[model samples]
Target: MGRRHYILPDCQIRPGDPTDHLDWIAADIIRRKPDVIVCIGDFFDFPSLSSYSTPGGVEKEGARIKADLDAGHAGLERLMAPIHAERERLRTGHRKRWEPRLIYTFGNHEERIDRPAKEDARFQGVLGTHLCEVERFGFERYEFLVPVEVDGVWYSHYWQSSHSPRPIGGTVDNRLNKLGFSFVAGHEQGLRYTNRPLPNGKTLHGLVAGSCYLVTEGYRGPQASNEWRGVVVLNDVRDGNMAIPMSLDLQYLCREYAGEELQAYMDKRYPDKDWSHLA
Candidate 1:
């Protein structure tokens, strides 16, 4: 049997001039034809908002916020249209071939939208409605901890937090070993670390999918060091029973595919800053 490959791309899409990198990435995916596509999180940089109603029975603030969200949603849809089209084509073509799953986990930004609305059911209902629209457009698929078994290997967006106080198998490394399966998470943006020990006399194999989007301006200024943007492709080798790691050089791809347009957009957006160092 052929191996199953999982592509994890972190797309923190912010309001911008709609770069072509998004389309290139989608086209690359269609060309590669992976077994599954997993969006790490933060698909829409700030597509959600919170608002309050006044005692005067007028939803003035709510209406304005909704308008802003609608605009952002429209912009994102335009930017993501090609990717959505590819996803639909894959879904239709693979209907009889194999039902590959699309998974999306909520990042810290999305969590903020859910926090305030947790108390008000009506607000939560509205949030759900918007999320449904996001899903309908194929921007995301699964939310929360979605489990999948590919060639007898299990995967989840979030590793379950350990309960033990001085837990022996509670640490990220230990928990993964105990689970005897590969784990992937994306809360942390950037490709800082990834540990994958052999399953010889040791415990288990662990892989951390890195972020695919550009670092924030704040993260780029003073705290900038090893802030590389890229995605991870995990190859589940069935014939040999191995997992190979391949890092997609997003920096180069962004430059090659996006070219001067992206630079111009960034320059116009951040006139004071200089991202000329980015290649």
Candidate 2:
């Protein structure tokens, strides 16, 4: 039987951001019961350890590592709550448990924990990826930028160029041409997909989707914040091949699971801010 793969892009869960989207995703997962679920990384946005800004600078002020970790833990628990509840219900009723493989790739944001720690001996033991405790959540954790292949498809936070440390830049077609394989990744914001056919008629697919959360970053400003946000579902996947993928955008997920249109939900929940870009 063909397997279904659910790909959740970078949630970027951090302190002060709403995490109801995680619950929405969990509800959808409970209903779909996909064979495999992949979190394409950046589940935690460690702004406290962000390298983009100077440490102890104005941008880094008021950002606490503990607060950031706590938020991530809470968000992750919310994401798993519905699934855990469903599993418990199944066990009580003596039904087969719906257990899917959970895979999490570490993104550049998660790498923040290591960089400062590696440079300064004082942070060595205190600051580490182990603090997040992803393994406890039944997720197979991968290092930043490392690729993990499942069902013949390569999955990574983002695929880097063979010659450089930077990610393979340009269009999805460029990535497909460079990698020359079926792969799914998350890092760049928004969604970009392309496929190529082989001589033997098999096709290779490439997907790049990030930004799964409802909040927009100040850095993105108003215009750039309007990028696509949501999860992806791949059906009939085998041998690193896939049929056309399905996009489950935030609006669709919220409307179906939350029973409210995304705009209305945002307005009622976060009325103080302008969420026009998200519309």
Best by TM-score: 2
Model 2 steric clash total: 1
TM-score for candidate 2, residues paired by index:
0.96
lDDT of 2: 0.89
As a TM-score, model 1 comes out at: 0.67
Model 1 agreement with the true structure over 105-126: per-residue lDDT tens digits:
6554444456556878777666
How close to the true structure is residue 192 of candidate 2, measured as C-alpha lDDT? 90
Off by over 4 Å in 2: none
Question: Each model's number of backbone clashes?
Answer: 0, 1
Per-residue lDDT tens digits of candidate 2, residues 118-152? Answer: 99999888888888888878899998987898999
lDDT of each: 0.53, 0.89
